[model samples]
Target: MSLAIDFYDETNTITEEQLNMLLELVNHAAIEEGVDAGSELSIMFVDNDRITEINREYRGKDQATDVISFALDDEEEGEVPLNLGEEVPHLLGEIVISVQKITEQSLEYAHSFDRELGFLTVHGFLHLLGYDHMTEEDEVEMFGKQKVYLEQYGLTR
Candidate 1:
């Protein structure tokens, strides 16, 4: 019963402390959200160019976004399970974050880099848990949750 995270830094910019802090924050959020303990996810840090390419290919947006999430088991309620019998870790999905965007947004928002990164990381994680911000109500719910989670993690602006 544990949360397994596969972290990859394509831009080679994220520090060890940042990674550890993000991991702690994610773990806390996962527990609070009641996610299965045996769940897994990946977080990849990339440059602006890489993220822009990914956004264009996958999301049809030719711009650099702060974070993008791909959920593996995004089945709706009452949907059939993909795995059978064995208790394997649920692969939630991958979170792709743009390091350049983090830096840019930190400056733009007049917030610390840690605060920006924490916000984006949790934002992407919530998406993996089936949270979306397409509608006004949905945005309120999702963004509110993000604020609570960030504040709880002591990453407040």
Candidate 2:
């Protein structure tokens, strides 16, 4: 499948090789999820302040989250308008990740930075694929799938 992952490192904490690996892992996630090729999504790395603002504005929560996803393929009321009659979609939505929080979480959870990053990336990508964790069952399914992808990517806690 053709998946374009625009990885923006605003924090500049990660190297080019690391970024490449992250992008590749995202592609692996898409393939695992059975997403059609040619889907495009954006992943932005930012600091806590930026993420806090986004969290407040979009999700109505005034706090800094590790990651936030905006799904763009839905035609539901109040959501983004769907692309009609288009073979390739321009947007599947965007994922905003907080670099500082990632490091903190990595340390807090006693895992490698790559592992935390992989978890967040996989979690966010799943959201883009129409997966949600509003309930216990959903959370189990989503987390289970995420764990498998991480294992395949060699990112273990």
For residues 125-149, write the lDDT of model 1, one tens digit per residue: 9999999999999999999999999
For candidate 2, the 10 contiguous residues with the lowest summed lDDT are: 81-90
lDDT (C-alpha, whole model) for all candidates? 0.93, 0.87
Worst 10 residues of 1 by lDDT: 81-90
Q: After TM-score superposition, what is the CA distance of residue 93 in candidate 1 from its true location, in Å?
A: 0.2
In terms of TM-score, how similar is model 2 to the real structure? 0.90
Q: How far is candidate 2 from the true structure (C-alpha RMSD, Å)?
A: 2.4
As a whole number from 0 to 100, the lDDT of residue 5 in candidate 1 is: 92
Candidate 2 lDDT for residue 78: 78
Predicted candidate 2 versus true structure: per-residue lDDT over 43-82, tens digit per residue: 9999999999999998899999999999887667777654
